[model samples]
Target: MTETLRARLARVGQSYAPHEHRPLAGYVAAMGAFGALAASLAAAAKVTGKPAPERPSLGDVALLSIATHKLSRLIAKDSVTSPLRAPFTRYTEPAGAAELNEEVRDHHSSLKHGIGELITCPFCLAVWVATGLTGGLVLAPRLTRLAATALTATAVSDFLQMAYDISKHAAEGD
Candidate 1:
């Protein structure tokens, strides 16, 4: 049955984009997984008798925005995190600020290629990060806020460090 479904999907994909190696199957799977994750979070909340907040506070929203930005970049581009992405991406170059450039690997399986693309792009990873963080906010608000605050602090520190470097360079040039 799985093989038959795959064959039918391949035919449909071919009909849709004969010239492009589009990973429609992979995208479908990814979307299904995300849906499942969301459902699981909701189920857990119900099981625990936790109520969702009526609305997130502005401060929490700002904190989460910065935290998500930092985390998504860390996961997708940080040199230290390359091992996690190594299977899906090829090292291309240094991207400065302790970040690495990578290109998604072309695998025989379009699913793998699609996943690689997802893991390698910070913008793409942000949606997943935000979802997880939002879920965490509901499931464990204290822990989530603590973690988000730490990430936000680190992001602020990074900007300050860069600014200091620029000032030092300007002084030296003079």
Candidate 2:
């Protein structure tokens, strides 16, 4: 009797055990995807004869980094995306001082679990977002800067809102 493909895959999965290897596999997959994207973007740029900037200015990197960070957080935690994320994650009751309710991976499958991990983790998503924004900067500087500016402004607004809430709470306590 021959072992079926599914059986072979099951055996392979078992070798990785305890679920720890799933995330490593997922991350490796993500990096491969990122590399492929970067290569494609580079080819497109070359074909279009778009000149690469000699060097991205320090300020441009700073703005893009902040905007990417903010956008990743918004996508990962904001209620607006809860519907999209619902299928991928399990919701838990918010713990003390938790601004956004906890949503974790359901771990239904390695692929789904990997996607859930990427979607829920700001740090993981930031790499993708930053790459996209950086690509945009190269492809369309004006438009990219406009979008990044708006995101950065929103980040500042969020900080101000948090500060105001803290001050209001302190005032009430005093």
Candidate whose TM-score is highest: 1
Q: What TM-score does each of the candidates earn?
A: 0.92, 0.81
Assess the local accuracy of residue 12 in candidate 1 as a C-alpha lDDT between 0 and 100: 89
Encode model 2's per-residue lDDT on 29-75: one tens digit a residue.
56678899888778877888887889999999999988998889877
Off by over 4 Å in 1: none
lDDT of 1: 0.90
Off by over 4 Å in 2: 1-25, 94-99
Tens-digit lDDT track of model 1 for 1-174: 277777887898899999977777777777877899889889998999888889999999999999999999999999999999999899999999999999988787867887888888889889888988998999999999999999999999999999999999999995
Error of 2 at 55 (Å): 1.5
* Model 1, C-alpha of 86: deviation from truth (Å): 0.6
